[model samples]
Target: MDIIKKRRSVREYLDKPVEDEKIEQIVEAARLAPSSCNSQCWRFVVTKGDIKEQIIKKGLGGIVLANRWAKSAPAIIVACADLNFLTHKVGAGIKGIEYHLLDIGIAVEHLILRATELGLGTCWIGWFNEREVRKILKIPRSIKIVALITLGYPKGELELHEKQRLDLKKILFWNKYGNCEG
Candidate 1:
């Protein structure tokens, strides 16, 4: 719960290098995440140096808001999945696309939680030009890029701000839709 509460979309970061061992631990946590049919089609590309810079530039073309902050992070993890492997197994037909995406989401959340536990920060970046990213990373056409996560130590304390959300009465129903009162 403490880690959950501390997990925030940190945009700013300190100019400090994250240890490789810590990075490995975070990836290990993600690796242990549940997958659809235990297929585990997810692939992680950890980026740094010129390659990371190129990814940040090409990737941010679609996202106008977090481009600047994304460039500042020390490292970026490009999450990709083999489409065929995820949907088909041992000559099987398409199982479900939703399952693949859900599996990736679960893995990403595990990464975020592990980052928080390690006193690090992370921001899940989804708004990117997939084609550009594919080209930048030299990923094969058969693979699908799911998300890009920026990781680093936070620059400062994050202030809790009010977030808009649906009320319990509006969102929850006793047994059917629209049955609860405000």
Candidate 2:
């Protein structure tokens, strides 16, 4: 919870490069995330070098103008979902819920929290040209570009501020929908 409180969506990053070992640690966290029916259907593409540049500039720079700052980070992680997972597909069709999407979210959260614990700044990015990203990575049409995350050491000192959120009473309930009195 302390690490969660300390994290923020940092847009500015220092020019320093993140170590390969730290990157490995970040991915390992995602690997440990829970998946529905044990059907792990996600992919994480950690981009750097020229390909990373193309992804940030050509893929997202024009479409998401407000997020151009992501280019400053030393690395970007793209989360992809392979729809070929049979268990999740069957379960989703039967239950009318997309388990793969939920699995991806859980994995991404683990990745972000691990990055924060490692003293790295990160921002969860969802607004981008998905088609462009798929083209850049040569990802098949069967795969989905779930999310993009920017990561690096923050450019300057950032002090933690109180997080803004609705009170627990408004979001949590006992057994029923209007059971907030609990």
Estimate the overall C-alpha local distance difference test score of candidate 1. Answer: 0.81
Model 2, stretches more than 4 Å misplaced?
Answer: 158-160, 179-182
Q: Encode model 2's per-residue lDDT on 1-182: one tens digit a residue.
A: 78888888999999999998999999899999999877778899989989889988877877587888899999999998889888877878899888899999999999989998899999988998888888888999989889999989998764556889888788887777865353
The worst-scoring run of ten residues by lDDT in candidate 1 lies at: 86-95
TM-score between candidate 1 and the true structure: 0.86
| Clashing pairs for predicted structure model 2, backbone only | none
Q: What are the models' TM-scores? A: 0.86, 0.92
Best by TM-score, which number?
A: 2
Weakest ten-residue segment in model 2 by summed lDDT: 173-182
Clashing pairs counted in every model: 0, 0
Give Cα-based local distance difference scores for all models: 0.81, 0.88
